[model samples]
Target: MEDEILGKAYDGRLMRRLLAYLRPYRGQAIVALVATIAASALALVQPYLMKVAIDRYIAQGDLAGLNTIAVLFLLVLVGSLAFEYVQTFIMQMIGQRIMFDMRMQIYGHLQRLDLRFYDRNPVGRLMTRVTTDVDVLNDLFTSGVIAVFDDVFTLAGIMVVLLVMNWKLALVSFSVLPLIVLVTQWFRRNVRDSYRTVRVWIARINAYLQENISGMSTVQLFRREAQNYARFDEIDRGHRDANVASIFYYAVFYPAIEVVGALAASLIIWYGGGRVIQGALTLGSLVAFIQYSSRFYRPISDMSEKFNLLQAAMASSERIFALLDTRVVVENPAAPRQAAGGSGHIVFDHVWFAYRGEDWVLRDVSFEVAPGERVAIVGATGAGKSTIVNLLLRFYDVGRGRILVDGVDIREMELDALRRLFSLVLQDVQLFSGTIASNIRLGNTDITDAQVRSAADAVHAGRFIDRLPQGFDTAVAERGATLSVGQKQLLSFARALAFAPQILVLDEATSSVDTETELLIRDALRVLMGGRTTVAIAHRLSTIQDMDKILVLHKGEVRESGSHQQLLAARGIYYRLYQLQYRDQELRAVARTDAR
Candidate 1:
């Protein structure tokens, strides 16, 4: 992912890439640029104005002339300050707009990404791309880009005016300039290198905090609080050390550059003073040249500090763009063949798949279910049972062959429309923080309050739901933390029923519930699936025994498929699994009674 966001310095094309975002704000940007130019021009006046005041007003003081010159200088000063204020405000607003717009674009791109991307990347890393990386770009917009322009314009303008006034004196003031430029370059290099290190350490600190918080329960349960704290301290210390190292460079270097600047100023006084005594320069000219020297190195010293900010932004821009650039591996087909005709029937024809390549979990698997058919898939752990359901939903595309719905390949259909046609309830039973009615409404937004209550009662969730603090209006916590696992599963059933899908899939939906609740849910589901095609994958064989068909899967192949009585009579894989589960339950029951 980092490779996706190029971090190896500014890509010479950054101006082009960055300008693309700026294009929409060209009008505002032009206004800000014009303001900045006006600000720079006003700033150039003070030193020359001082030169004029010295040569005419103060030196050969006509008292009236002195007062008028003073008024003019004050006016220039106020105007300069006003322009600068406007410039800063406008630039900051532009930066914020850019941040807001690009952040929305990045967030939208993330939504388009496939689930496989989430499985590959951590949530914390993705969040850093959104938050930390964007913060970096925000700094770039506010200061990095604009400051560079401000310094260049002000620096160049001063150089031109200084030479026009007195070229010889300008030369004298600039005698140490080459040395200062070299030193500035050297310092900038060191600061950038140090800042890059600081950015890395900061990311490490964020990652550590994220991981520990996410696993807080495990940390406490393992009784390793001290150990975890020690580990965090170690990471915290590394970030602290990097930050301190960066500060050390700035603290020592900025003052050192100032000393060199002061030395250059002293030389400007000595050399220009000699020229004035020789009748080669004037008092005003010498003064203005001295002012020029001060103005010259001010930007140099400030830039040394701002260089660190630029490097930090550069580091962050890399990560943000990387995420923005990543294309989801699963995408709609090009020149898509429209779904020919689907009557809600499904066919998995010679399908093959694996999460990772080479190690196949499902191989040339073939199956078909007619409309309104009820089939149960039975298998042990790691038997590729869930893969079958995942394929049907097109959560993944098949490695070979195709999956068809209503005799049309699903990949050719619009993904949202295709998935919306079926209702799925899995063992995990995930629910976001929302009211009971709101959660059910997700299955089909058009469902009414009456429909919601009816669906809830059908799944037997109504038993404990009204007992909730606000009944159907009771808000659930994240992942239904406020509800028990059985309650959550039943809510999922209610939501599923609300969809009224042409096909229903229950993958271990009753695996976590009590027997009594499971029986009630099973009875309701039996009624719900009456006219709908149903595919059930359950750990216990009892609920699925009455299905119209039961398919036994092993090593990604169907070992046997038949109804309950037919599989039992055949004495095949399904028969053996049934006997094992029920026989163990019988023994446990007798043992419990005897112990009592």
Candidate 2:
């Protein structure tokens, strides 16, 4: 929908911002402009040289002068070609550099943006901004912006020559100027509408493809292939129709310009011929007028084309600037306090938070974890369990209360310093494309190969790693598709352990692994949790029964807090949850016995 909104063809505000990217390469851009001007001047010389060759040498029957003029004409052609190459090469190189800088700026800004921004924007749409929209601006830089000057110069030079040579004939040639303006306006308006449609469909196509491709396994398991194909076909058809419609405008516009140019040429011939017969205009001058008339319409048509390019760039720039201008809701303090180094003491002082307005996910939540204490949070789905971890990491600032680490509010601490205090492992492990050892180290050069192997062995992940052909050097596919869910979880444990953070935060870390795999890591979990503050969120009560403390969350409030055995004796929410799991286990046991 944002793509559907087409702003002005030339927005001064957007133009100013867009030009700032060119500022860095201003020297190269100047060189390119100079070359463009030189090329335009050289091009104008060729037509006049032709007039001189015909009128002065051929008509006068002077063979030597004709040969000299021919040599000069060839030299001008060569000079023009040389200047054209210099201009094109310089502008293209500058465009690429600006594109690189802009993308880096965009990606860096994206990295600094808070999670709430991601919650509001889709990955595909943001990707379009970085890739597609930036590409549109690149075209403006290389082809539209610098090249427009050449057209303007050529048009002006041709008009001045025509007027100076024969003002009456030049006036006759300019009679069709109004018709050219009308045709260009018609083309620009229609093409702009079609271009907007095309942009909207492109964004839709990208969003649809990213979603379906990422969830292809689900689509296949549910046998929705044909239905997905139908939806994709519809989006594809819309994009195709939008392109074809734009092509129709282009198809009509160029020919109409040619017809208009021909009319101007016809007028020059008729008017200039009469003046020549009456001995008012020289034959050489008449020929030059005809040649200049032909050259005049070309820049006009090119100017129209550049106008469309300018319009597309304006639309693209609006979107890019909008993304860049999005205010970071959660930001680091200007004068941040240094976090006091200790063994992780966290306190949530009556914290209140809502992702959306007034729809509280965590309400007046209060808790504390002493140094090296292992605390477990248990609740139903959507009971604000993960929100606790998110808040602890300062992913989103709390709405109404303060979260403090070592007697300092987290908001007052540097973001990197605050987040570095903990290592998080989630139920869904995100493994990038790299080797097993690289994924473990995660670009942290301080984590040597020995440390990587030790962390893997501590988590019992080395059991599988050793059996592989390449061992620790084994390659991981995208999202670790080559590994089982349990194996990926083991690597995640190894990765978290290698970091050696002061706090270990596990949010449903063992929820996806099987019982055997979970058992494999029980001792590893102890090793990871030993002498380090641990906060684990688990749906399976058995996995967290040995935790130092367990906090039961009901709805958005903390209902009870105690050890597992203490909470079980009270017979409240924890007891009911335990009874339900106990019943299910009993049923499963009975079924196994019957089968045997």
Candidate 3:
């Protein structure tokens, strides 16, 4: 629906913001503008030269003068071509530079936006803003903005030449102008609607494709390939039909302009030919009027096309600026305080938060982790266990109360400095496309090859890395698709270890791996947790039995807090959780023994 709103064809405010991108390239834009004017002037000269050659040289049987005028005509043609090339090349280069600058700005803004923003917006829609919408603005810069001057200058020059030659014939030529206006208005209205439809369907196509491709494995596993294909075909067909309808308007518009031009030419010939017979107009003048009349319609047609470009650009700029203007709900402090280093003490002082209004995900959740202490948070689904971890890392700020690190409110510290103090590993490991070594270091130049291998070896990830032909240099596919789930989890651990943060946060980090892999990781966790303040969130109660403290949450509130034995002795929420897992494990053991 947002895509369907085309807004105005020429919005002054949007145009100003779009023009700001040109500020850095104003010099090149000026050059292109001057070249465009020069080219238009040169084009106007060609027809006049025809009049001069016919009336002064050819009519008087003067071969020498005719030859001279022909040479001048050739020179004018060459000059025009050169200026046209300069104008086109310069504008194209400026467009490309603007696109680069805009994309960088958009991506930087996206990175700064809080997680809540991502929770509301879809990835496919954002991708359209960066890729498709930016491309439409590029067309405006290269073809619609500065190049419009050529059409205006040519149109003005042609009108002046027509009136100077013969006012009566010019009036006859101008009679068709009203018809051009009517046809253009009709074309503009219809084309704009079709263009909006095209944009909407394209965005839908993009969103559908991104969703299906990312979930292709799930679709295949469920045997829903045929259903998904049918859905995609429907979306693709909508995009195609919208485009064809837009093409239909274009197909009718151009030929209509040509027909009107031909009518103008016919009027000029009919009226001017009689005047020549009446000794009021020269034959050369009549020929020149015909040429000028034909040239005049060209700019009119081009301006109509440019109008469509301007309209499309206005719609695109609206979307882009909306995204850029989204206020960052979580922002760094203006005068940020430095986070105290070497101490990972964190405290949540009666924090309250919600992803939506008043429906709290976490309420009055209070806890603390002293430096070098290990804490675990356990809860049922939607029990606010991970919300506590999210709050500590400042992914989303608390609505009430505050979170502190090292006795200073995290809101008072620079975002990057605060986040650098902790390394996070989640159940779903996210690996980018790169060599195995690069994924571990993640572009941190200080991490050396020795450090990378040591981190992998410490976490037992090197076992698989060494098995690969390229070892640490092996390339990883998108999302680490080439690696097993356990292998990916190990690499994630290696990554966190390589970063060597003062605090470690694991959100169900080992849940995806096998029992053998989990045992290897449990062994490595002893070394990883030593001397580091670690916050672990887990559904498996076995993993956190030895933690210094355990917080049990239920329905957005902490209901129990103690060591494993203390909570088990009380026989409350934590005791019930332990009993459930213990029974499940016993049943699994019995089943395994019976099968043997």
Let me know the TM-score candidate 1 reaches against the reference structure.
Answer: 0.93
lDDT of 3 at 521: 85
TM-score of each: 0.93, 0.98, 0.98
Model 3 poorest 10 in a row by lDDT = 1-10
Off by over 4 Å in 3: none
Poorly placed runs, candidate 2 (over 4 Å): none
**Worst 10 contiguous positions by lDDT, candidate 2:** 337-346
Per-residue lDDT tens digits for candidate 3, residues 135-166, read 99999999989878899889888888888887
Listing every candidate in turn, what is its Cα RMSD in Å to the true structure after a full C-alpha superposition?
2.5, 1.3, 1.2
- Clash count of each predicted structure: 1, 0, 0
**What C-alpha root-mean-square deviation, in Å, does candidate 2 show against the real structure?**
1.3
Task: Summarize candidate 1's per-residue lDDT along 1-596 as a digit string, tens digits.
Answer: 35223254555465467767778888877777777778778888888878888887788977898788789889988987887788788888888898899889989999878766787898878887777778777787777676777788888998899889887767766777777777778777776776666666777777778888878999999998999899989888988988888788778677777777687778878887887799787788778777777888877777766666665666676567667889866676665655554456888899888888878989888888888899999999989999999889887778888998887788887777678779999899879788988988774558999999999998888879999989999988887878888888888888889888878998987787787878887887886788888888988888887788888898888888888999999998888899999899999999999999
Give candidate 2's TM-score.
0.98
lDDT of 2 by residue, 523-566 (tens): 78888998999999999998999999999988889999999999
Instruction: Give all candidates' CA lDDT scores.
Output: 0.81, 0.92, 0.91
